[model samples]
Target: MLTYVRWYWPNDDLWNYEELDADRWALRHVELRGSDGVFLAAASLAEVLTARDSGTVGAVAEYERRYGVVPEAPLPPPTDALEPALESVSPGEFERLWRDARRQLEQQTGI
Candidate 1:
């Protein structure tokens, strides 16, 4: 599968500076490729208007009830010796790490 660039943004109605602190806001976006990458899909959200028209009222109900309460992203990984160990790094540096790690893995497997 191709990698994607997903990001977060505010949804306004549910979130604002008053509701959330200075560091926070409402919705987050997880963009995915569709229709030759022109059209985008968010992994966390379904198409509300389309779902309503499709007679998926149950889906809409579920969405309304569970949208903000549950996070679509994976829970934070537990710290352990075997894990990759994440940290904050710039994109350029991160890419370099990915390249180096790929080389190491390939070397180990003789790929």
Candidate 2:
């Protein structure tokens, strides 16, 4: 199953989406898809998430070095829904959903 996440920059017209593998709860792809569903640039999810988890400062530096410009806005937290994610959600709602998902996944995988 594929879980889609939409991210909008602070002042940018175009948005990006992260397509994750729901079974493994891992990222699979990232891209800026048009309304007609045309894909723009794509990149490895593991690579991007790894960079993000490392540290914001380091990630910004790496992005700037590679893309020539760092992302000015951070990704907004996901909503509290149990299924498909939303574009905007409260932090509290996101935390609740995250904790539940983590617990359930851990129980199922015993990891």
Query: What TM-score does each of the candidates earn?
Result: 0.26, 0.30
The C-alpha stretches of model 1 lying farther than 4 A from their native spots are 1-73, 76-87
Q: What is the lDDT of residue 85 in candidate 1?
A: 32
Candidate 1: deviation at residue 58, Å?
A: 36
lDDT of 2 at 94: 39
TM-score of candidate 1 on Cα atoms, chains taken together? 0.26
Candidate that scores best on lDDT: 2
Instruction: Give per-residue CA lDDT, model 2, range 41-87, as digits (tens).
Output: 33444556667788676884553333222223333335434333345
With a 3 Å backbone cut-off (N, CA, C), the pairs that clash in candidate 1 are none
lDDT of 2 at 90: 45
Q: Write the per-residue lDDT of candidate 1 for residues 2-111, one digit (tens) a residue.
A: 12122322232121011111232212222222323221222123344444567765866554333223233342333545433332334454344334433543454466
